[model samples]
Target: MKVFVYGTLMQNHRANFLLSRQKYIGPGEIYGFSLYKVSNWYPGVVPREGDRVKGEIYELIHEAEKTLTRLDDYEGEGSLYQRILTKAVDQKGEEHEVFVYVYNGTVDEEKYIPYEQQPWRG
Candidate 1:
């Protein structure tokens, strides 16, 4: 399956080891989501109407389960983040159903990350 990554897991950053071996499809935009600064090193996303988030898409292969499990723990799934199936439009205008990590908590109005800025660049 494809995964949408907008923060440390996108291109170059820490905690991206899990995606190092995966096939990078391309850049994409996931609609109905908003990005926010979670910390200095990472950003979190949440579902929101009329919003969009930019990120890269990767196809998970080779021990997908293990990688996903590790990512779950790292992302604090069920607490800080939750894995969800969402649709994203790739650079080629192709829509893909991808798994994305979304913030589980409430988004503060002060923490909104605009599209013009890198999500993790706090």
Candidate 2:
């Protein structure tokens, strides 16, 4: 299984331990969505026309199901964030269907982070 990750799960950020054993598929981008700083430590992505969120893709080669379950817990699936299958385009412009965790609750107006500036900076 392949998973798309932004925010902390990206290359050098924290929470990467969850993917330490996974195969790095390279940088990728998901279109028609915008990323916002939901908090000081993480960002949330929501659907928006004409927008794109940059991230990386990984292939879970071993214990794929267990890895996904752990990711669900880390993401607070069904509450804080919801994991969904979506298309992510790689640096080479090739698209692959991957799972991404999206914000599930209401977003505070004051916390809105524009796409021009990367919101993953902690």
CA lDDT, every prediction? 0.85, 0.88
Off-target runs (Cα >4 Å) in candidate 1 are none
Residue-wise lDDT of candidate 1 within 1-122, one digit each (tens)?
88999998877777678789888898899999889886766789988899899999888886788878888888899888999999989999999999999988776779789887744543
Tell me model 2's lDDT, rounded to 2 decimals: 0.88
How far does residue 72 in candidate 1 sit from its true spot (Å)? 0.9
Output the number of the lDDT-best candidate: 2
Ten consecutive residues with minimal summed lDDT in candidate 1? 113-122
Worst 10 residues of 2 by lDDT: 113-122
Model 2 lDDT per residue over 58-122, tens place? 99998999999999999999999999999999989999999999998777767766666753666
Clashing pairs in 2: none
> Model 1 misses residue 117 by how many Å?
2.1
